[model samples]
Target: MSNMQTLRFYVTPSHNCSYLPDQKAKTLFVDPQMRISTDSYSQLSELGFRRSGGHIYRPHCEGCNACQSIRIPVELFKPSKSQKRILNKNRDIQVIRKFPIMDHEYFDLYKSYIDQRHADGDMYPPTPEQFHQFLVEGSIDSWFYEFRDTDKKLIAVAVTDHLHQDMSALYTFYDPAEEHRSLGTFAILWQISEARRRGMNYLYLGYWVKACRKMNYKTAFRPLEMLIDGHWTHYRQE
Candidate 1:
């Protein structure tokens, strides 16, 4: 029997929900003391766990099962018409894959993104310590896709984690000034392309909450599979 089944788990006490307002949420976390190997990380991802900094957790809210783990079947994904336009719009933007780094340029982009775009969120007034702890300090095999304009100025970044037979789309941030570029959608489309280019099987998108307007965009990717009741089922938008 694999130790993956025996790994220790902990549930965090209820806290305010980040996605749905006026609701409580709980999280299930793997024991922080355990040294998770790449294989173990992949297994956890398969079980709907996501990495936040070095912590791997999944939503375990009481009376609220709205957060469903979602992923794209790389080979089966067909971009929508709008998604195609987003790709064409960003053709001038160059994407470079690089290892995650803690640099001022990256932090500046993140701070600007949070300030202008997510000011009402918990990450408001983003700090260097918070930036490092959220995206840089993770132990997972992670890399970032740096999106730069023709002038070579940084415009956006896609933080991703590599897993066995899959790639996890962790987070994406962009210059709010470049709103017309729709960099967020382009980032995911590019990841799906990159994942297929590498012959990977799936691209794990963290979670989808139908009632959360912020999370509804995740279903834009076709042939999406959602982990429901411990099973991955095709998602049909009704």
Candidate 2:
């Protein structure tokens, strides 16, 4: 099953939670020395692990299990009214997929997205080295989908990884000024559709924290499956 059971993982020191305020988070990551193949990475993904550039990890908090890895079953995915509107609104933008590289244009848009939208977050004051390490480096096959306006100006970039039966979204950054476009939601919709088009079964959206407002949008996609206690089950909002 992709040599997953044989790999070793280590835990990271506790750090401030990126989603919940004041809460600490620990992550379990695949051993850095182990070489990962596409099949092995896909197997690891099935276990709730996610890619973070050079490393693959998932939340390993000692006392908390707030982070639930979520994914969209592409074939069963039905876009809601709002998502359809987002698709209609972004019809003008062009989506092009290419190898994951530190293109100057992509980096510039990433810088802008961080500077204006996430200035208060940890990624504020973005740097070239951080960009390369956090988004460009990975063990498995990965790529970037560049979203451009009519004038060919880049507005969004989705860093994604191609795995066994699913396409995992590593990260997505768009022009914060294009808030009206709802690019973030649109990114997921497009990914879902694109994954279906490519014969993929699922589109992994990473973790969804029930109490985190920032993660509330993840539930908007119907029939979403969340990994809880090592089992993937459909999430029904109560």
In every candidate, how many clashes are there? 0, 0
Residue 224 displacement in candidate 1 (angstroms): 0.7
Top of the candidates by lDDT? 1
lDDT tens string, model 1, 1-238?
2258667899998899998889999999988777777888898899899999878899988787899999999999998899999999989988898898889999999999999989999988899999998998865689989999999999999999999899999999999999999888999999999999999999999988888888878988999999998999999889
Candidate 2 clash pair list: none
Distance from true location, Cα of 61 in model 2, Å: 1.4
129: Cα error in model 2, Å: 0.6
Point out the worst 10-residue segment of candidate 1 by lDDT. Answer: 1-10
> Which candidate has the highest TM-score of all?
1
Q: Flag regions of model 2 displaced more than 4 Å.
A: none
The positional error of residue 235 in candidate 2, measured at the CA in angstroms, is 0.4
